[model samples]
Every structure is written in structure tokens, then in C-alpha cells.
Target: MTDLTDRVKQAAAAAEADSPPPVTDLAVTDTALHWLQSRQSYFTDALPRHVDQAHFMSVALSIMPALVKCTHESVHTAFLACARFGLEPDGRQAAVIPYGDKATFQPMYQGYIELMYRHPRVDSVHFGWVRERDQWDYTPTEPSPRDFFHKPRVDLTEDERGPVILAYAFAWIDGKRSQVIILNRAQAEQIRNKYSGAYKKAERNAKRDSAWHTDFDAMWAKSAIRRLVKVVPTSHELAELLKADDDADDTTTAPPVIRGTVIRNDDQADNADNRTTWPAAAEPGSGATADTDGGEQA
Candidate 1:
């Protein structure tokens, strides 16, 4: 009888150990929704008028599990960026990527074009990668009226098109191509090696998870667009968007604080005027249609 009792006790203990944890607590999604709902006004005020709160909440909830794995503060900062930029965390326009316990908000190249169109001055924006097999030409002239042309080879498969040799971004203003910027493969690599801390870390670990590795073409185009934004006239919001991306690239520094819709960098507190401010919501039906010249790879 003593032996049987001991055996039964051991069996019960083993079963308990093998069983899953009880579902007594609220799920990550539920908790995140509750938290977001509690601060609904804060997020709603930051979002552009075109993006409804209900839709944003649904998208946020879809990614809540991943966001919950990150530190609470980091999650808040990431969502703050999402709301302010009016980009969804749906992995298209923007994404909240996890770096160990911290999460960073990364706006996709599409997101850049989206915000560019929000500028009343911008008529259209386009970014494309030049393949080694593609016919490309650019002739820069004095003062104004530069010539540019590109014809990607249709006979070749995407891989057969060969490695990307160049990336370019162009913008139309007043119904004409007013600004153009191009980056060669070498220059794009230099920018990645210099500014992408994530790329460096991935190199050390022999991992190819960084965007620089997974989406080289997109990053290449983005680099060109980033350069174009500097020379072209853009809104304060567009400039801030670039700054936000720059901050994400520099992982060595502490994350910026989101103070009432402003992304204030603690290290740059002396330059308070350069802080990011929430842009006014775009007018309904004024958003520009996305350019279909090049589709961003998933």
C-alpha cells in the first residue's frame, strides 16, 4: 500500500509537469487591446484622417503577439511611430521588428512613398532597382532638364535579370520629373556597412535576417530616396520620417522618447527644434495612388 501511494504521487507530479500552464491570465492580444483602448484618444489624434481608428486597432491587434514579446516601453514607442506616420504594422507599409527584448519601428520603402505623396507639393514618387541586364541611361545637364531612361529586360526571370547594379528614386512635381537620385551598388553597400548596426550584428552571427540582407533591393531604393529627400523640397513630416529611420539604424543609442506625439531624442535634447512633430492629418480622397512601376518584394 505504501509503494502504491508513492507511485500514484509520482505519477500525479509528472502529469502536472507535462500539462500546459493554466489559461487564467488575459491573452497578449486582449491585454494589448485593452491598453490601446484605454489610450484610444492618444493614438487616434496622431493618426491621419484617412486611417480610421477601428482599422488601425484591428491591425495592431493582429501583430500584438509579436509586439508583446518586446519590452512594454519599446512596444509603446513602436506604436507611437505607427500612429504618427499613419502606416500600418501589417508588414507592408511598416513593421515593428524585434531586436532581442526591444522592438523597433521600421517604415518600408512603400511607406516612404506613401508619406511623400502626403506632401502637397509632391505629385508622384517612384523607386526602382536597375539590373545588370537592364538598359539604363542617365544624362545630367547643366542647370536643368536631365535625361533618364530605363528598360528592364522582360525576357529574363527575376533572377536571370542578374544582380542589382543600381537603384534610383524620382519625384514628379508640377507634373514633371523635378528630382532624381541614384545610388550605385558600391555606394549602397557603403551606406549599409556604415549605418546599419543590425547588419553588422547579423554578420557577426552569420545570420541573414537583417533587412539589408533579406530586402537588399528595397533598401537600395530607399537609400536613393533618402538622398533625394535631402535635395528635394519636402514637408517637415517627411524629414522627420527619415530621422526616425536613422535612429532605428543606430542601435547603440537609447531609444527616443515619445512625448505627446513628439519623438524626442534624449541625446539631441539641445536641438529641441529638430524634434519630430505629428503632421496634420491628410485630407480625405487627396492621397496619391501608388506607382506600379516596381513592386516591392515580400
Candidate 2:
């Protein structure tokens, strides 16, 4: 009887050792691993090499805690899906790189569009980059002001019409239909200038910057989606996901989770009333403005 018991215990221990540990305590398993492998395989011939299994796993594991903090859930199948969409928990905002470089895996503009459609209240999300003519032609009606002090305004004048735009607007049709629009001339001009400089600088590899300049719509879409999602009230699950995003932008070297971009905030920058002054030529007739109270206009 004693011999039989010892043999059973040894068998159990051996089986346990042979099996792999859970990917994370929250929930990833064979399914997530298999899914990742399949995705990596699908992108085999793509220009920028897809992230290897090891790098993906590293980011996924590091982001799990922030996931828990945001949603009270751990690593799970949905989290895997989220990670697959370029939303990394390691604090790397979508870093754009040249073809040969290790491209940053952050949320794609398209991914955010899909996410908005999935929301119960959001009926549509529209994003675009437009010149004066297009922006003027399709200018949306302004919302009525709720505050007594602020009066409603009229359409843009001929002089004000030509301002370049990176527009992000959405419609909600839950009960009473409503809409929100955000136009960020500041970011639009900033991104344009950066890309234009890159285009001019890259003599040998001009194609990359040229493509970037031509793809202004996508650039605007990405910025719009990032800003809009942060402003809108979402469910706890989505909010938790965004918390990871928020943490990634933290400048502190010793942040709790992984961080990709480091923004050093000075005393002035941290204040709510202070406008961020970018060191560049200001656009004519442009100033920091907000549509919603206590929210960024751009």
C-alpha cells in the first residue's frame, strides 16, 4: 500500500513539471499563445517584421497589472485581443518608425474606429484631415452653449476658412441624438511641419516621408481617436484599458508599469490653467481653445 502511494505522488509531480505554467495568473493559456503564433505567421512577408512571440509575451505580462488596476481583471482572452490591436501596456505610445526599425506597436487609428462602433451609445466616428475648401464645405453646426456667460457663435469667415484641420467628430444616438466635434489645428500644423521636415531631410529615403505626408488622413485619425477616447465616458473595462495608456505617457522613471514615452512635466505644465506652449511659429488666428468645459478643444 505504501509503495503504491509513493508511485502515485511521483507520477503527479512529474506531470506537473512537464506542463507549462500559466502565461499570467489572470488568464492567458494555450489559446492566446496559439493565436499570437498565428498572427505572427500571417505577417511574415510584411515590411516591418512583426513582434516576436518573446517580445509580445514580455509586453503582455508587464501590462497585466495595469489591466487589473483598470478593470479588476487579469490577463484574459479579451486582453490578448486588445494587445493585438497595438495597445501595449508597456507605456509605449504608438511610436512610428522607418521600415527597417522595430516599429512601435501602439493602437492603430482603424482599431479605435472599430472600438467606437462597438460601443452601445456611439453610432459613428468620423475622422479626417482637410484643407480650407473641404472643411468649409462640410462645416458642422455648433452646439448650443449651456453656460449663461458664453453665447453661440457663427460660421468661419473667409479669412478663417483656410486653416488646415485635423478633425475628429462623433455621433451618439442612444436616446436623444447628439454629436461632438473636435478640430485640432494645433496638432495638425505640428504634425504636418514634422513630416514635412522629415520629407525634406530624407534625401535617400524620401519615399517614406512622402508617403507619410500623403497619408495625412491617417495621422489625423490617430490623433483624433486618442484624444476623443480619453474625453468620452466609457465603461470600466474600456477605462481600465485607457488607464494603461495614461500610465505609458507618465514621465516618471519609476512608474508602476512599463512606459515607452517619457514626458517631463514642469511646475507650469502641471497646472490646469496653463496652456502648453509649443516652441514653434504659431498659426495665424490660432489659440488654445476647448469645446467642452474642462476638456482639450483639439
Model 2: how far residue 79 lies from native, Å = 10
For residues 1-298, could you state the per-residue lDDT of candidate 2 as single tens digits? 0135655777777778995432234333333333234333222222123345456555554433323222111122223334434343343323322222112123456655555655688766655445454423333444432211111123655455565543745544454333444557677557545544343444345554432354555556665676677645465545544554343222132222322322221112333212222111112124533222223333
Model 2: runs farther than 4 Å from truth? Answer: 1-103, 135-164, 175-179, 188-219, 230-233, 246-298
Cand. 1 Cα-lDDT = 0.70
Report the number of clashing residue pairs per model.
0, 3
Off by over 4 Å in 1: 1-38, 142-146, 204-209, 258-298
Candidate 2 least-lDDT 10 residues? 144-153
Candidate 1's residue-wise lDDT over 1-298, tens digit each? 0135656777777788996432323465565555445445556678989998899878877776655445555666788788998998877788888776677888887888888888787888888888999998888763334477889999999799998888888888877776568899899999999989878888888866688987787788778878877766678778778878878877777775443385422212233222122112212233422122211112
All candidates: TM-score: 0.71, 0.36
- Screening candidate 1 with a backbone cut-off below 3 angstroms (N, C-alpha, C), the clashing residue pairs are none
